[model samples]
Target: MGASFFSFSFSMVSFSSLRSSLVPTRMMGVEGQWWRTSGNHWRAEGRDDRMRGENEEDSKLSLDFTSEEKMEIESIKTYKKDLLDDIQKLKMEIDSVMAEILSFESAEENKTIERNKQFSNGKKKFNMDPKKGINYLVEHKLLDKRAQSIAEFLYKEEGLNKTAIGEFLGEREELHLQTLKAFVELHEFSDLNLVQALRQFLWSFRLPGEAQKIDRMMEAFATRYCDCNAHVFQSTDTCYILSFAIIMLNTSLHNPNVKDKTTLERFISMNRGINNGEDLPEDLLSKLYESIRNEPFKIPEDDGNDLTHTFFNPDREGWLLKLGGRVKTWKRRWFILTDNCLYYFEFTTDKEPRGIIPLENLCVREVPHPRKPYCLELYNPNSQGQKIKACKTDTDGRVVEGKHQSYTICAASAEERDSWIEAIRASITKDPFYDLVSVRKKKVINQTPQD
Candidate 1:
C-alpha cells in the first residue's frame, strides 16, 4: 500500500511540469499573431498615403490641361475677331465703290439719252467714235471717267472678251489688258497682284501728293495709251511707256520753278513733243545733272531761312572727319548739318546719329592740323566739359564744364573745309527779319547821287 501511494504522487508531479511547458508555447504563438496584425495595419496606412498623393497629382495635371484648353480657345477667338474686322473693312470699301459706280452709270445714261434724242431728231450732232470720246476725256483730265469708258469700249464696242483679247494681243499687251481688266473689275484691293500693279502705276507719276491735277492728267494719259492712244502704240510697242516716263522726268527738269503746270506743259517739254515721246533736250539734260549734283547743298525753296530758326534740318547729308580722344586717331563720320545743330551718324545711311553738337552760342575757327590735314575747331563757351555720350573715346575726354567745349573736325579736301566754314558762318550770321533792310541798303548803294 505504501509503494502505490508514492508512485501516484510522482505521476502528479510529472503532469504539473508538462502543463507549465504547454502554457509558455501558447503565449509565444499569441505574441507572434499580435505583431503580424500591427505590421499589416502600418502597410495599409502607407498604401493609403501613396494613393492620396497620386490623386492630388492627377488633379493638378487635370487643372493644367484645363488652363491650356482655355488659352487655346482665347487665341482662336482673337484670330477670328481679327479676321472679322478685316472682312468688315473690305465690305465697307466695296460699298463705297458701288456708290461711285451707281453715280457714274446714272451720269452716262443721261448723256446717252440726250445724244440719242438729238440723233433721232436728225440733228446729226453726236460722234459715236469711242476714240474721239476717249481723247476728249483724257484731254479734260477725267481719268476715272476714262477708265470706265475704255473698259466699256474694249468690251462692248470691240466685242473683245478676255480670251479674245489674250489671243489677239502680244504677251506684254495681254498682260497690260489683264491689269486693266482687273482695275475695271474693281477687285484690285482684294487681289494682291492687281494691288501691286496699281502701286506701280501710281509710282510712275513721280510727283508729290499735292500735285493732284498733275496726277489726274498723268493717269488719263496712261489710260488713253491703252485705248485711244493705241493708234500711236502698236502691239509690239514697248517704248511707249518708257518714252512717256522720260518725257515726264524731262518736264520736271525743264521747269522746276513752275508749281501749277498742265499736262500740256509736260508734253511740250519733250524733245519729241508728246506725238513721238522721245528723250530730253540737251539743255534740260544739263540742268538735271547740275540740279542733282547741287541738290544736297541747295536750301529748300519753301523753307530757305530754316537755319535761322530751327534746330534740325533733315534735308542735307554729307561726310566729315571727327577727332578722337587719342592724339593720332581721326574717324570719318557721315555728318548732317541741320539749321541750328549738327549731328554725326555712322558711315552708313541707315544708322541713326551717334552725336549731336548744338550750333547755338558756338564759334568755329580753322585749326592747323597736327594729325588731321584740314581741320576746324568748334567751341561752345557756355558748355561744361561734359563728354558727349555718342562720342566714344579711349584716351582723355574733352572738358565739358565752365571752359569752352571744343570739337575738332576734319575735312577730306581744302575746298570742302572752306565750304563748311562758309556755311557755318552764314548760318550764324543769318537774320531772317533783316532781309528787307539788306535789300533797302543794296538799293540805296545803287541809287544815283542826283536823286
Candidate 2:
C-alpha cells in the first residue's frame, strides 16, 4: 500500500543506469533516394534493388514468408521482434499476480486487518528495511560479491547509495516511490535469496535475472560475432557487453529493429516478469534492477537525418566539397575523404578519347538512392561519376564559411570571386555529366555543427 511506504529510499539511480546502459545501440543502413520501377524491380544508382516490405503490410502470406520477409531489412528487424514479444508476455503475467495481491490487500478494512489478510492468504512481502534483507542474506553466506555490492548500496550509510544511485539516476531525491514500493515488498521475507529470488521472480514474469546467465550468454555471443576480446563476467561495466548482445540481437535470424526501444522494453517487461507495483504502475526505473543484470539498453531512434557518416578525408578533416560555392551533398556528406585533396587521374595518349583530366577529392557516396547507382552512368571510359565539389579547411580543421555558399563556374572566374565556378567547369567537359565520387574516411557523426 502507498500508505505503508512510511520512510524509505528510492532509486533514481536505477533509471540513470538504465539510460546509460543504452550506450551503443543499433540503426538502419543509409537512406534517401528517388527511383523508378523496372519490371518487378526498382532501379537507383543503376543496380537491382531489393524490396523490404515483409509482404506488403497487407498482403497474403507465402509459404516461404521468412525469406520473403527478409527483403529490405536494415540488418536486424526480426530478432528484436521475438525478443520484445517474449518480454511482453512476462510483463503481463507479473502484472496479473501483483494486481491479485493488491486486490486482496485492499479488500481488508484496516492496515492491521490487511496484514492479517495477507498472512492468511499465505503471500509474504519483503520488509521495508533494505539493509535488513541484504545483511540477512549476506550473513547466511548466500550472496556473492556482486550481490553484496548491490546490497551495500541498499540501506547504505546515505540511506541508500544516494551518491552512486545519483550517478545512475542523474538526480537527487529523498525516496523514489517505485524503489520504496519494491523495497517494502522485498522486506517481508527472511529466507529468500534476494538476488536468486529476484531472478526466479523475473523468469516467472519472463525476464533475465542472475547476472551470470546473461553474462555467459553475452560472452559466448560476443566472442563469435563481435570478436570482442573481453570477458563479460570480469567487470560490472557491462555497457560494451550489452552493446555487443544488442548487435547480435540485431544480427540474429529473427531480429526486428535492433534500435527499437519499445521492442526492447516490451521484451524485457514481458519475459523477465518483474511484477508491476501497486504503488508504482509505470516508470521503468522500478523494474530496472530486475532487468539490468544483462545491462538492458535503450533502442536507438529511427529518425533519419543529419547522421554521422564516417569516412577518411585525404585533404583535411575540416575541409568539404563545394559546388558553385555551395556544398552539394548527395544525401549527406558527413564522412571525411580518405584520399588526399588533389590527385591527378591522368588519361594517356594511348587511351581513346584521350584528354588529361585531373580528378581531385572525388567522393563516392550512397547518393539519394538506396540501391546502387546505374552503371550506365559511366558508359564512357573518360567519364567518372557525378562530381560533387569539395575544399580544404582553415587552421583547426574547420570548414570556412566563405566557400560554403559559393559556386564554381568557368567564366565567373573573371571576377576573381568565381574561382570555385571556374574549377567546376575545368573538372568536367564533353563527359555530359560528372560522376558522383566517394571519399574514404574513418567515420561520420550524427551531430550538428556545434560552433
Candidate 3:
C-alpha cells in the first residue's frame, strides 16, 4: 500500500501548553497508553546517500598513503558515493508520492456500489484523485482526528466504512508515524556513515577525544545555524549540520569577546617549556621555546619556511589553541620537578601557534569550577641555570606557604574543542552578576607550584 507522509521540519512543534517549574502540577495521565494516540506518530528518518562524491581530488587521493591507508580511502570513496545515491533514491520516492497525490481523493464519496460485482469480489474499492483528496482533507482536517485510545479503537469505527475517510486516515496515520520512525532511523544509519566519513580524518589526525565530540560539535553547530531552525538531530557526523551551526553561532548567539592576544602571549612567554618532545632534536627544546616565545599568536605557514608567527599583532588575525597534559617527570636527579604545574592557553581570535611550548614553561589555570577551589600554576623547570646543578639546591622546592596544587589535566581535542567552548560558556553565563568584561584581572600570577 502506498503511504502518505507527514511533512514537517524538526523544529515544527505544536503544543497544548507548557508550564515552567514554578507552576507545578500533576495532571499527566496515570494509566492511558500515552503512545496509543496514533500508531502513526513514528516516522522514518533520513537515509545516507549511497553515493559519496568529494569534488576535492585530495579527498579521493591515494598518493602519499600507505597500502592500508589507501584501501581505507578507497572504501570511504565508495561509501560516500553509496550514501549520496541513497539520498537521491529517497528524494525520488518522495517526488513520486507527491505526484501520486495529484489523483488521490481527500474525503468520503456517497456514490453507491451496492456491492455490485463488476470486478469480481462483490465489492470494489473506490479510487479518488490523490491531489484533490489531499486538498479536501487538508482544508477540512478529515484525516487527523485524534481518538484518545487509538489502539483500542483501531479499525473499530463502523462509521468509517465505505468512505474515503477510513482509507485516507488509516494510510496517513501510518505515514505520520512512519515519518517519525524514519526520522530517528536515519540517525542510526548516519552513525555508521559518519564514522566511515571520518575514518580517514581520525586516522590522519592525532587529536584528543577525536571521535567522541565531533558528533556533539556538529549537533550544536546545526542548532546554532539552520535558517529553518530545524532541531531534528539525525546522524552524528553532520558536517552539513555544522555548516548550518557556524552560521547560527555567528549570527544569533551571544558571542564571547575575542580574548586578549597580549595577555595570552604573556602567559605563554612566562611558561614556555612544556612542549619539549622526546622524539624531537636534542636542541629542539631551546629552539621550540625561542620560537614559541617569539610569536605566541601566529599560525604556521606552509611556504617551506618558518617565520615569527607567535607575536600578538601579526598582519593577519587568527586563533592559537594549545593543549597539554603531564605524562611523567623525574625527581632530585634528571628531569626532576620539585612541584607540579598545569597550564592551558586561552588565546584571542588572532592568536596562532608559531611553535610548541615547553613543559617547564607550562601554566594551566582552570576557570573555577562551581564548588571547588580554582587553580592556576606555573612550572619552571630550572630556577637558575640550564645545566643540571652538580648538586641539589635549597631544601628541595622549599614550601612557600599556601600555594597552588597541581591536578591531572586533559586538553580539548579538535573535535571536543567547540563543544568545550559551549560547556565553558554555559558556566560563564550562569552567574547573572558576573560580567567577563567588568571583572578586573591583571597578568594573573599562578600561585607558585606546590608539591
Best by lDDT: 1
- Candidate whose TM-score is highest: 1
Superposed Cα deviation of residue 77, candidate 2 (Å): 99
In model 2, the runs with Cα more than 4 Å from the true position are 1-174, 177-232, 238-240, 243-252, 256-451
Q: For residues 118-147, could you state the per-residue lDDT of candidate 3 as single tens digits?
A: 211211122233224344433443333233
Please, what are the lDDT tens digits per residue for candidate 2 over residues 1-451? Answer: 6644532223445434433443222222223232222232322221113435535532422321245333433234454455557677989999999999888787755766755554333211112233343444445443332433443333332323222222222112323323322322333223332232222222211111122322332233223222222321222122222332233332231223224433455534432212211111334323433343343222212211111110111121212222223434422112121222222111222222111112333212111223322111101133344333434444464543333222221111222222222223233221111111100000111112222
lDDT of 3 at 252: 23
Q: Tens digits of per-residue lDDT for model 1 on 194-295?
A: 113333333221221112222233343345344533442232122233333343333343434336543434333432322232333545434433442333
Better of 1 and 2 by lDDT: 1
Instruction: List, in order, the clash count of every candidate structure.
Output: 6, 92, 77
Candidate 2, run of 10 with poorest lDDT:
436-445
Candidate 1 ranges with C-alpha deviation above 4 Å: 1-316, 325-328, 381-404, 432-451
